[model samples]
Target: MAILKLSAAERRRISAFFTCLVLALVAWVITVLSSSYNYTVKEIITFKNAPLKRAFHSLQSDTVNITVKGTGWQMLLSKIREANHQIKIDLSPLDYEDFVVVSSQLPAINAEKAIHNQIIAITPDTLYFDFTNRSVRRVPVRLIKSIKYMPQFTQSGLSIIKPAYVTISGPSNLIDKIDVWHTDSLVLKNINEDVTTALNLRVPAEGNISVYPKTVQVTIPVEEYTEKTLELPVKLIGNVDYYNVKLFPQKVKVTFTTSLNRYADIDEELFEAQADLNLWRTYGISTLPVKVVRMPAFCKLVSVEPGNVDFIVKR
Candidate 1:
């Protein structure tokens, strides 16, 4: 191996040269990235101000290619944001004309671009629509839920939704097909307390179908549950053959869980323990299955003690 020794002055010159090279590279990058440029991006098309008297179905597609003019900085961010964004166009013009020019909406579209980006042109610059008879109807809202409750906690009563119905307007054929509008799934996890929240209705799949009051208020009552047990008198049923029949066990212990608020009001009167005598006539079995046929509302049945009882029949 060979080593090259340099003087102090030589070392200083080498350091200065390297420093100038690095500075020059950074300045070049900044100048290039700051300059203005033009680019193209794809965007989804949406409509605003649809006419009420005339139901319309767009004949053109729901997409467009937008040519944008902006600095280098906007070119980097526009592509990412454009994918999630839709360019809304005014449909009021469709009242008189069947087609619309995208150039007319450039000013309004550019106003929302905060990155100094301007829309230059859009492919398929004209939008066209087909007309049909319009119809309107009011339909009830059916809420969908995917919820989980903590141990011994559950929903106490029916969920309440404000403005129970939503109005839908669209082509006559489409309007007739829709019956009830459904809300987006209301999801909750390990919920122990009452819930009051706003939920959005499902988005219309067709371009012309419109729903009013897209959002609804939902309230669900939640409560912790406690166990209750009662000795209910067992009744016999299905002895139509007129044979004297008797069951050894006349009562059963019914165990169930109910909300804390309803625990006091729940009693044996609300429960029904039954033993069917059809077993003795049809299957000729000595044991009859005892079942709880009725119970209080919002109560969960845990078990029925003495599930089977011995029975004797005299013909």
Candidate 2:
């Protein structure tokens, strides 16, 4: 075989091709080592109560850190934004453990360096609820209906057909200090006849309580009758100084014509006949209010004819 020497141009061309290939390979290796990728994570989170569920729903703690490794180009393309990155966790799977919560699993990352990598650690907060049973108690009854009296005279006293009381149930701690509930108010402005009314009951102001038998039967006794033809002098009983009331008609002339049996129980005191000017005087009111005078309990006012008498007052 005859040996032949290669041309210089041919050798140079071959060397150049090999060098270009090596440089390209080196660039690719650098890109792979410098890049990073994204890994996904799933963890179980829990809260003490229903209200606190939102706080730990997202992995929102600095304590949790995720790190991934991959080609530099891939890592640059991947994003680890806090708002976009999320961990899947279930709360219902939790068992009663402690007021403070611990995640069942650490967040798994979707990122990778292709080998073992750290995802993220998660921390959760817990909330608690208290439940208990309470006993029964009695509360006051409040009337809801409105009443109007005759123009000349007003109600002297409020009579109840039956006493008012209600039973309530609630938390044990709150029920202990409570004795009875007081109703708001019952105002009978200008009623002058026998009236039968039903009243409603209400709880005290700003109270957290559960009442038994939500509704109750309330009866208000009302009646209107003429005064007796017989002139009966007015007599006052009970300490008036407490109410600050002044009696103007120190004595009223009650005139009534009735059977001896009907008149037997009639008296000034029995009829609750007296001027309740006590409240009025406190506010500096001078006009005397027209009201029934003292009379027998059994004798009802039939017709006074004149009804109210004019009296002179100093104070």
Candidate 3:
């Protein structure tokens, strides 16, 4: 096998040709970077150092459309670092009922260098904002939670929320109408054990209002329950008129299930079983359905014996 090697003169010529190509590429890049170009960019506008006693009720815009002119390199760098750009407007000098027309106050580049870019135009050359007197109010926080317990277990008491109330500050017109703030919805299924968790409070969609302490702790108590039986007397409802009505088996067996702590509080008086006589008189029926009128809230009514009772009327 034979290897071909370049002679000294051929090597020098090849090297010169490559060097010229490299120089030409560098010159082209420098020319492109030095040329000026115009760019349109969007920047967020924020309020800073606002007065403690004043609130902004409305703002015409939260962003500005800016057209800038700079060297191509500067524009490229600006686009890459645009995320750090923000135009802050100070509101400390404003008073209630005062309106401010805001203009662009361009930010420095790279935290040290003054931006060489000229702001050709700002779409909203002037921005407007309305100010109002700030008002503070204490509003109750309502927890929004849905819980389902496992069979044989139930909620023993009222669900509690820590920091039941929150403070809200905003324009008087907006704060005066807000009476309650609600937490985000929390759902727990097959929850046999007590639940304690932190939940975020819902923020009003309106930009004029702000709520303090954006979260609250919620606790739902759960307990094991036992079944109980009670014998409750049945009563007649509606007037019997001239007829004397008598129902067979005037008492019913009421079976219910309640939490162990509330088992002792269960009594026959907390339940009412009644038969309506108006239906008997209206339809001349000898048998009437017995209905349980009232029951304890914490107890689940399991069964009522003899759903229908025979009745006899005598004039």
Candidate 4:
């Protein structure tokens, strides 16, 4: 094929013609998008202002289509946000009536709408509910955590949560099954010292359940650990027959790591090592596994010098 080349002056004219075409196309889009248009969006319903005396559950699908008039730009953004947003419906009227009008809450819904958009109608404009005995219960907050501690450091005690219990109010059938409310995951990395933070309560997927005080304060006690070793006398356990038995090694060394604050106080008295005699009585084994039955909650057991003890039973 032969190559075709253009002069500088011809190239300039060609580029300007193409640029004008692009400009005209862009101008058309701006005008079209600026025009008012009506669009429909499906928004999940979030019930608020629930009735105090009655427990209610939505009888119909939780989703509703909202018809709104807005500029094309607003309609475009609303479509992008449809899956991420919800409309709040007041259920306070459910105290006396079984239904709520969605249009009645338009003022509240309009406040949360995107700029330059107006909601005209909500499909299934009336919300219906089924009633049951209302219930309010207090349940403990279970902390969900993802924590990594620095080497030689660990939690000293149970994490403390302010307002350890959250009040759950809903239909008895629903809240009754919930024993403990879990918090959103609290993540900490390479933590060497005590941590104090707040955690949000995980939202219940059920629309009827409500939790007051959305967040709880959490304090996890962390401290650097120090190793301690002690020789503890082994006591024979599971000796129901009280057979005359003796362990070859009556004592075993216990190695554990404890917080510096408790290292000085954690002694042999705080720990008890026992050898299970059930192995000798039931299975007729000569060796019993040595286990520490009691230890301070803050200590992490490392190892026992003699993991098993040899026992002899005499008639």
Residue 274 lDDT in candidate 3: 94
* C-alpha lDDT of residue 64 in model 4: 88
How big is the positional error of residue 223 in model 3, measured in Å on the Cα after superposition? Answer: 2.3
Query: What's model 4's lDDT at 252?
Result: 95
Q: For candidate 3, which ten residues in a row score worst on lDDT?
A: 104-113
Better of 3 and 4 by TM-score: 4
Residue pairs whose backbone atoms clash in candidate 1: none
lDDT of 2 by residue, 77-115 (tens): 445433244444334332342232333333322341223
Global lDDT scores for all candidate models: 0.88, 0.46, 0.79, 0.87
For candidate 2, give the lDDT of residue 233. 49
Measured on C-alpha atoms, candidate 1 has an lDDT of: 0.88
Tens digit of per-residue lDDT, candidate 1, span 175-200 = 99999999999989999999999999
TM-score: which is higher, 1 or 2?
1
What are the per-residue Cα lDDT tens digits for candidate 3 across 1-315?
Answer: 999899999999999999999999999999998999998888776666566677775456677777878888888899675555666655544654364444434442123224667766666765556766789999999988878889888787788988999999888988998899999999889988888999999977766677889999999888999999998888998755857878888888888889898888888879999999898779877788888899987888888888888888777
Stretches of candidate 3 above 4 Å error? 1-40, 48-55, 66-88, 101-125, 131-137, 169-177, 226-229, 240-243, 264-269, 278-289
The ten-residue window of minimal lDDT in model 1 covers: 77-86
Per-residue lDDT tens digits for candidate 4, residues 1-315, read 999999999999999999999999999999999999998888888777778888777889988888999888888787665556687777778878989988998888889765548889999988888888889999999999999999998888999999999999988999889999999999889999999988899987877778988899999999999899999999998988878988979999999898888777767888899998877778877688899999988888999989999878877
Every model's TM-score: 0.78, 0.32, 0.70, 0.80
Give the lDDT ranking, best first.
1, 4, 3, 2
